[model samples]
Target: MTSAEASAELRFDPPGPGSYKQDPVHFPRAATRYWAETHPPAFARGTADFASTYGMLLGGLQTAYVNGIAYIVTLPAPEEEVPQRFQRAEEAMTGKLWREQLREWDEICKPESIARHRELQSIDPDALSDEELAGYLTRCRDHHSAMITQHMRFTASAVVPTGDFLAHVGDWTDLPPAELLGLMRGASPVSAGASAELERLIAALRQDTSAQALLASDDDPGDVLAALRDLDGDAGAAVSDYLDLVGNRLLDGFDICEPTALEMPDALLRAIRTAVDASDEADDVDARVAEVRDKVPAEHREQFDELLGEARLLYRLRDERGVFSDIWASGIMRRAALGAGRRLAAAGRIHEPEHIVDATLDEMCALLAGAASPSADELAARAAYRATHTAKDAPPTLGPPPPPPPDDSKLPPMVARLMRATGMALGALFGSSEAEHEEHLLRGLAASPGVYEGTARLVSGPAEFGRIVKGDVLVTVSTTEAFNILLPLLGGIVTDSGGLLSHSAIVAREYGIPGVVGTREGTTRIADGARVRVDGAAGEVTVLA
Candidate 1:
């Protein structure tokens, strides 16, 4: 989230109501929402409710990346009957009657709202007081019952890259250095179509499902190559350029597009703005806190430090991380979205990938539709909504971090059963039965097309940083925000996780380096030092030695 000042200044200033004559901005038509449908009333999906998605729709021109693949629990819903009114948020909670303990405040500070207080204080942080906490929790639980509806269907999604689908132009470096520097220097409009040819190439990928069909087909290599040869200029060029792009971005961290900004919903813009401002406030507080200490006794400083260390960690602005907040948060998000979209397209990905910015699953698709692209009014109108109501979009409070377990003698069987059951249930749902695929060298879904023979090194974490030598093909799990660490040393990349928009894929395209991803088990299946052939357009990896 932290970056250079150049990132914000390059944005296309938001024009008044209407200005551009190019094609209308596109937004997604179709929308997909993902929520866990559970059978047991006690089951909690945790933060899984916030998993993200991206896509677009425009009449018949549509694209989607819906719910990612995830484990599902398929047990039947309770047989008991329930009334429709109870289904809403409030009714279910009324059934449970709060006992006298629910009214108590002696523990810590009681949460303000009755429901919130019960929800949080119901748990004993220290297992040592399980009996006391359990008694109190039981009392609080009575005044609150959960709403459970029958499960009609259930599915979960993992955020796969859609390779390039969610990356920024700066991410893949699709735009050449001169243009990039121009935008960085405010010498060029963000919309400066520096490489119009690339736009066409990416457009072809958005329109062509033929690549998917061809790759999925049982046809021989001869047929595949023949079909590719017979394609139109755009398709053929897309194939070649896509392959080359992926290879370079993955290997070199170059982008195929100049930094461009996209539109952001008003709500998310405000949230980011608030977050940034709050961060700055936090920095100010920390500095003043020391000043406060200088006037205090030394003995109190140690106590103050300990207390502060244990205090809640809130938003802070220790650094100028979110520089956009002071000036144009909305513009920053828009540009970031545009940047993401540019790279995604370069990686041969479709959908309004720019929609990934602050989009819910439903809004995610809308951002992709040719007709659905938000107007500047819509994107900036969040300020309007706030004038009407105080809708809260911040994440729901995390009830509480678990309190430490006490000595064994204070433990109770009921507490142990609950804790162990929770772990077991979660493990059973998410655990994979497939054997771990092991390989030192793994091939990934190609983004840029190329064939290179290089040293292979597996990077599992920052600790493995030293192993990466120049020109080495770095292979590992999904290329995420952290991949930037290896950028200076890697020549190419291979990954077990992510599609084209993935960090690994886009970075490869930016660098014009070769990359392959979404291999699922590339890390476990490929061994180090193995010669490999990466076909980015076809998403294929062949082991040579």
Candidate 2:
């Protein structure tokens, strides 16, 4: 009431449709990030993908994930300066309470969290011995797992199929029959039959890029399909099986399928060798890309990216542009899609592999719109119509979050301990979904970068917060209203559970310290006083032994 005091800002609940207070599984950020799904990121652009290897392999995984869909009419277009707008709105509405809580959390959890981040980042991945590398990788994997396991929003954001995939679902049918087939092929599921079929087709791809490339260049993708159809009887069936396997996975891309660990998968290494062989025969890669580029329609030329994307999709599982990432995952998406489609056809349920990946939700409804299972050709037509005409769903708007949970000053000791543990535990285990057996940890992009060396105190639950040292890194999973008091004495922050916009990040920034938010398993993997370095810019942390 005094003139010296600033009037607290008013927080207004925005209108229309929005996501839950926060997603329970992924993307725990306060700001809305639905647009990040499926679409190319505004911040991280890349060269045009020429190989259907990974690019077109995209839409295969996007179609089935509903959570990636956002109601766009509610917010600014993706290209706008939305982050600043959100920050301002957030501050104004809650009297800057969220940021204020961030400051409070910073004062509570910073010191120790920051110390651990710096110590780990100082060590590099290359310098580690085999044992150290294994240990570090385990920590990384654990970091990823914790985020997925504890924070609902964190779990959703890191692994959701993506936004681009969601928008392009209706467009999958607009391409030529063969490219449609490739899309379906990429979406198929993996199976014993599909694997045998894939080997044969890949052998052909390894030997005959010229044959298919020639057809693609001439703008007659279906010609390539017809050629493929003429393969020796056994070989033809194998290819068909491969295409069907991919189709199934594409339709349900949101489902997680972690592959068993392998030093180098033969299927992928073969692709790289094939590319090298093709390029060696008189530098043909560029010429081939140009040939296909020229065939794209003048009016619809920009859409050529879809073709390139498909090419990249095939390559992503293996090549990764040139040098392979040691962390590359297995599982053949395109081949799997093809395999799934064949299975459906074998059961006499669908017509072909292409029909599934390219099947629009509307067309699927229309297919089922029939009293019984409709003919394959009829369903394909409806799908084609929807592909050319349907507009993608829009993103949901992000309004200001509700007022801060409560002040830290008045918190009881038990409540504060619980909140600290919740945040720390969630942060400690970020990525653990992809591996099999003892490979339980994962690595992820560290959003809030900082460094602080400290003794790591792993707290699996709330009861351990009482043992936190003033200079120690508080390792825990989730953070809530109660944990606010612990912030001031901490050196740095490491959470396995949240994103850049998560509570951990906000607090770290407020305290003017380094914060590696969304590490997932930071508490479990990084031991007490295990030196580490976290580079937010690089999205990695170096765990020093």
Candidate 3:
């Protein structure tokens, strides 16, 4: 089909009122009915919580889906609350309230979220009866929704301090965000797929010769993984523990429609192999920190140190919030849906088990309960459309244009600080700088420093991950924090969307790999297996072949 014809076929009226911008940063692909239906309310609640906590003039964000693409718009806060919000913003700026929020995340939020995920994951959906499975799906959906909100609730705390550091450091020195963000390299271990469980697994595997032999065996990847998980003693226990932490988590996107690690055994096994073979490399963080600090104006050096400390302190939350909050929960929900789908497919009720993910929660429950509405054919069609279409097929925006930003000149000093810090951080988080490029070259944000030339592996989704070998450059639409699990296998990363503060950029910097993001056409311009040079410092990708 022609581009215009496809666009027309997919176009639909806006869900409600107000201007809406596509959120390709999070949902680059078309969402399934299950995610589209449950995401909005939870997202709105979470953003509202962040706004109230930071005293923003905006109430929270609202989402709507058109042709399965998610779009978002900000709601306005009540006029009467503006004064109170201003007061609170002032207090938040001066007090650095994110510190308290950080402590809460570590001591309360992170642990509690992990516990909840473990509890839900422990239940075997296959063991439950039809009625019991329906109830379990309901619980999964509810928890998934709550986790979405939880992920958003800490959004401000995660972004503000990092943005504050960027803003201040940018003024004090002429360095780009990519260089400054390198200071955050050691902060978020989660972004590098590091966990205590992983460390333990590595240690145990090193000592257990039999487990090592099994991992290195030529047996089917699935069988190797199963044997590893069931192996005897500390080695097996450690492998099981590590899988419990990561196996159920989505390997790519955030939605229930995305496949979990366990679902992609080959890639998961490869990643495990890579992790086992990986060794610690020398870190130049201190030298880089000192070099950047020396460049800052003498008068601002002390303040720069303070700002850098705070940014690093809160940087882990960037990935931790999403990874701990909804990513795991969404996978659990997918597992339950797949369980129901398996039974339905076996009974000849659905065309395919995976198609059940395209159904709404109620529809899924009904299907499990043997209802005939939303027939198998209808869901199959939905799945086909979602697979065929993406954010590229949808309009960049919908409804009226967004209002201009409020002038900070007349705002109170503290309120201005709040607005400036939050605005700068958020803008860098989502906005890309490069807009145009030459035919052989794709320009984007210089997300990570250095340069690398390698074969471009075009991966549209997790299913394509197996094509990526060690030192291959990953070219795709975008990547979420969950992609970190497989990042060790890549030489570099290039994306069509996302900015310097994006997960793709953050993980690349943490891994010390060259990364050019927001190229807008990297996937289209660079062919798979084509040798391409990625000059991340220059924000350019050149197709040499």
Candidate 4:
């Protein structure tokens, strides 16, 4: 089908109340393209299957768009009457088995996946036979698909208990959303690892004046990495070790458009700077957390405590599952492409190694099988064409937008809790918000509280991440948990999509930075490098100069 026809076809209208709209970043082009062509049958095996959920179905539609096929999805309408099955699931959601499953997934399944990814990355694709390479790619794709399913389940399950608690407590007090969720701050393995690694690097850098000075200098990240590598002591070893821990993670969501952490040294350098320069200015969140917990009403205090405990327990899993799921899987896919692309580039089949992402899995397999591969020029042309087409504006929906969220007061208690739970699941799926506004000041959800003024560095995509410097106000579409590595560098953050539960919001609160999220078009409306004021308390970003 023609590009226009495909784009038009992709504008699917949801048939029911539980539907949501997702940003293109959620399902990146490279990964989506491969999935559409290679795993067509798996897209909708069954609603009852582990892989097929309302959220994943939406994501699958998004995948079709990236593949240049605009197929829309209509989810099966949920039973109007709450079912016994849902109650059973909800009861199990916060039980011992549920918690154990999450813990098992994190402690066992996640690390095993990471190890497998690293092993795959180390393979010499050139030495493999045609069948072996194909088998390897299949394994990577299958593991990635299964991981995505697991991620959705864990995330959705967590959302139920957390959201139900929040819904129950909404009118009980005037507590801010950030404080309620603050218990999740700095708890994820991703943030903890990044913080700890940075601390180690800081300790080493402090003792080496030469290395510290070089790091503080306005040198390019590549140059900085090179200079650090040349250092013959502890500073070099520290930098090397930090990268070893974080370098393999994906820069964004499952989208192939984003780069891995290893490719963006400048962002990494900025993170290091934040760690070294941190002062007493960091938020005393633990102390404040105690204060918030103490504020529970005498009547509902026990329930409040239990709810908070559940939310905190579940919150950490969100980022942990993300690390093991799409983020890690994307890196593996990137490695597979890069590995094959390198061999192809050496053999003069593709113009560059990165161009491998542009080819379909079948095309890649053909190239590996010693069959005719697309010429370098042909692949380059296809890349350019796809880039332009993908850049064309995507219609948010095929028909009327989903109905607005129901008024909170109108919902039944159980239904209200489920609605809140659904919102969390939707947030995990789309990462965009329904917030609307106008003018020079962009309004969004108040993610973190504070005020700051700095030059706006709009990272429209991962490619522009290098432009960000310490203390700059970061404007972007949205960020993922993987971005925690660089969160400390920004004085504030503004995102075009995602709500308070978003990666940008959660990390901003953790790091005590001002942040406004879900400003639908913040990246487009705010000019890059312009001075701006971020009033995270008021949920607005205003251009100052």
Q: How many residue pairs collide in each prediction? A: 93, 164, 0, 4
Clash pairs (backbone) in predicted model 3: none
lDDT of 1 by residue, 332-445 (tens): 222333443454345444344432332332332333333344443443342232222210111111123223433324434322322232233222222212323234333334
Worst 10 residues of 3 by lDDT: 2-11
Misplaced by over 4 Å in model 3 are 2-4
Each prediction's RMSD over C-alphas, in Å, is: 27.5, 28.2, 1.3, 4.9
The ten-residue window of minimal lDDT in model 4 covers 54-63
- Candidate 1, residue 514: how far the Cα is off, in Å: 1.1
In model 4, the Cα lDDT at residue 406 comes to: 57
TM-score of each: 0.25, 0.24, 0.98, 0.82
Cα-based lDDT at residue 237, candidate 4: 88
Error of 4 at 300 (Å): 1.1
Error of 2 at 28 (Å): 14
Residues 1-545 of candidate 3 have per-residue lDDT tens digits of 75446767755677788889998888889999998899999999999999989998789999988888989998888789999999999888889999999999999988998998999999998999999999999999999999999999999999999988988899888788877887888889999999999999989998999988998898998899999988899999999999999999999999888999999888888888888888889787999999999999899999988999999999999999999999999999999999999999999999999999999999989988889978989999999888877888888888888898778898888777778888888887788765689878888999888899999999999878878898999999989988888998989999988888899999998888899998888888999999999998889999999
Off by over 4 Å in 2: 1-253, 256-340, 343-351, 354-400, 408-411, 424-545
Is candidate 1 or 2 superior in lDDT? Answer: 2
Per-residue accuracy of model 4 over 363-411 as CA lDDT, tens digit each: 8878877766576787786666555454224555444555555564664
Give the true-structure RMSD of model 2: 28.2
